[model samples]
Target: MPDLQRTRDPERWDEEEPPTLTTDVTIEQPKTIITRNQSPDIAFDRSINAYRGCEHGCIYCFARPTHAYHGLSPGLDFETRLFAKPTAAALLRQELDRRGYTPAPIAMGTNTDPYQPIERQYRITRGILELLLETRHPATITTKNHLVTRDADLLSAMAALGLMVVNVSVTTLDRRWRAPWSRGPRRRASGWRRSACWPSAAYRSTSSSRRSSPHQRP
Candidate 1:
C-alpha cells in the first residue's frame, strides 16, 4: 500500500541538497604566542601556529580532532572553518621582551601550517619572522606551500647567519592521490629543493607516511 501519511506530510520525505562548504574565519586574540613543549623528542621547546584549521583537508590529519573543542565537526568543519591569530607577532615580541627570557630557535608550523593560504592576506607569519630577524632570534619553519619563497630575501639573510631553517614536507608525490584530501595540487618537491639549496635553507623532504605519530610512537 502507498504511504499516504508521507504523501501529505512533505516534512517526512522532502529531500534537500546539502549546502556547499565555504571557508570562514574567526579572529582569535591569543594572549601568548609561544607554546612550550616538554617532550624530549621535540627539537624545539617553543613554537607558534598562526592559524588553526588548515585549508588542506587531509582526511588523515591527526590534528583534525582538535576542532571538536569549538563545537564543530572534526571532518568538514576542521577545513572549512578556521581561526587566525592576528596578534601573533605582537604577542611574541611581548613575550620575548619579558625579563629572563632566553633566546632559542622558535619553530613555526608545529601544530598547523603557518604558511597556509590565508597567510597571504594576514601576513602574520611574515611579521613574526621579521621580528625574529630584527632581534637576531633564530627560528625554524616547516610548510607544504611554496609560497614560503616570498620571504626568500629575509630567510636567506638569516640562513647566512645560521639563524634559520625551512623544511618542506610532502606527504604523497602522486598528484592523483592528494586531490581528494588536498585543496589543490601539492607543491612539487623539485621547487622546494631549489628553495632549500638556493637560500642554503636546512630544508629536507620528509614523507609523512614514513613517520609514526609522536603520541603513538614507543
Candidate 2:
C-alpha cells in the first residue's frame, strides 16, 4: 500500500485491489501491566492496556498515532494488526501484591479499547477485573463494545463496594449516525441503550460533558 496521504515522495503501486482489513492479533508478554502516569491532565495515576491496537477502526481515534512507533501505518495497520498481553492478569497480581500497593482506581481502555473483538479470545480484560475484585481494588473502564455486559457478575460486585466505574463510549443516540469505522449493524443506535441496562447495577456509567463532533449533525 502507498502512503498517499502523509507522504509526498511515494511511488509504489502494483495495480492490485487493496487487501481487505482482517484483524491479526499477536500475543505479547509484557514485563508489566499497570502503567503509571504523572500527567496533570489525566485523572488517574495508574492504568492498564491489555492490548496495543484496536479493531474498532475508528478513523478519528486519537490513539492511532501510537502505531507509527511500531513501524506500522497509523491508518489500516493500526486497526487490522493488533497486540495482546495475555499475562496482564498475572502481572497485575504481582503489582498489587507488592508492599505499599495502595488501593486506588485503575483505569482500563486508556490507550485502546479493552473490549475489542479479540478480547473474547484473550479474555485479558475480564481476567484483570476478576483479580481486582478478589483484592477489593478500585477499577474504572471505558469501552464501546457490548461485551462488557458479559462481566456484569464481577463488575456489579465491585460496584457494591464502590470499587468500579464504567463508561460506555456512545457518541450519539441517532440511529443513522454511523461512520465508516462503525462496528457492524449490531452496534446500531439501540446498542447504546442496551449497554445502559447491562451495567446499571454493575457500575456507574459516566460520560464527559463534551458535545458531539462539530462535523456531525444534530
Model 1 stretches astray by more than 4 angstroms: 1-21, 179-186, 197-218
What would you estimate as the lDDT of candidate 2?
0.76
Best by lDDT: 2
lDDT of 1 by residue, 1-218 (tens): 86565245565345332345688999998789999989999788999899999877766678889999989889888888999998998999899999999999899987678877788998989999899999999988877776788888788778878888777665566665553434334454544654663333323324443552221101
How far in Å is the alpha carbon of 88 misplaced in model 2? 0.3
Error of 2 at 8 (Å): 29
RMSD of 1: 9.2
Worst 10 residues of 1 by lDDT: 209-218
Relative to the true structure, how large is the alpha-carbon lDDT of every model?
0.75, 0.76
lDDT, candidate 1, equals: 0.75
Off by over 4 Å in 2: 1-20, 184-209, 212-218
For residues 1-218, write the lDDT of model 2, one tens digit per residue: 96668444345354233345678888898899899999999999999999997987776688999999999999888888999999999999999999998878899988898898888998989999999999999988887777777787887788778788777666544434433444544653344454453333221222555453211211
Instruction: List the pairs of residues colliding in candidate 1.
Output: none
Clashing pairs in 2: none
